[model samples]
Target: MEARDKQVLRSLRLELGAEVLVEGLVLQYLYQEGILTENHVQEINAQTTGLRKTMLLLDILPSRGPKAFDTFLDSLQEFPWVREKLKKARKEAMTDLPAVASVRLPRELSLPAQL
Candidate 1:
């Protein structure tokens, strides 16, 4: 996942932990989507509390590669408010990017210099 997406997840960690039902369909969906491995699901299910399970899920997501964020978002279908909040955060993050960052440099200028 992108750094901005990871940051958004971290920012909403507390809220997510409070609202996520770790023992429910979310984890199964993530596993089925291939975003979470069998081991990952097992680890999360082993957590003693809902909050701990969510925290572990949050911790694991950033390292699960690019599609993890979106797949995870999709798994939140039961929690429309949480999904909306995440979507809004993503939109805000995109808008907050500096205009200069979106401008592509000329090929020659974009090339790396020799050491």
Candidate 2:
């Protein structure tokens, strides 16, 4: 994941942990997309509370490679509000950067909507 993306996740950690529902479909989706390995899913699922699960997910996602951010974003279909928050954060983070620095960053990827 990009530094900016990581930063966004960090910034929203509290909100996400409070709001994200990771017990069922979210975890399944991420695992299916290859963003979360079986071990990762097990580790996250092992957490006792929703907050812990989400925090673990946030911690794991940054290390999951470049596609992790978008794949995770896609997995947020069950929580469109969270997805919008992330997209807005990403856009805001990009615009806050200096022109040259922003230019060096990867462009925002357009992801297909979850049906």
Candidate 3:
């Protein structure tokens, strides 16, 4: 994850918790690799912190029933973060990714979010 993404996750961790951090990081990595689009990030991030929003961000059990949700989940699982887990994965070219989403980040890195 990028420093900025880590910063965002760390800030969220304080308001949320470690589980949220993990889910946020997973979504962050997805965003970085273009699995999740800018619109998707913005929509999800705008939601108040909660399991429903988290599930939407994680592409699980979305309000739209199984068909819509499954398609999104399938695409997400094909993201480099998932597909490259066991391989020497290079960062996907930025040209291939949607423009970076403007997620809120804390001004300072919380200790746990530091590298």
**Model 3 agreement with the true structure over 1-115: per-residue lDDT tens digits:** 3333333333343332313422435556556655566777777777777554664554422333334322333344434444332121213332344687887657574355546
Q: Each candidate's TM vs. the true structure?
A: 0.84, 0.84, 0.32
Query: Could you tell me the C-alpha RMSD of candidate 2 in Å?
Result: 10.7
RMSD values, in order shown: 4.0, 10.7, 17.3
List candidate 2 stretches off by more than 4 Å: 101-115
Candidate 1 per-residue lDDT, tens place, 11-73, comes to 888988899657568999999999999999999989988899999999999999999999988
Worst 10 residues of 1 by lDDT: 106-115
Report the CA-based lDDT of candidate 2 relative to the real structure. 0.89
lDDT-sorted candidate list, best first: 1, 2, 3
lDDT of each: 0.89, 0.89, 0.44
Model 1: lDDT equals: 0.89
As a whole number from 0 to 100, the lDDT of residue 67 in candidate 1 is 97
Backbone Cα, N, C clashes tallied per candidate? 0, 0, 0
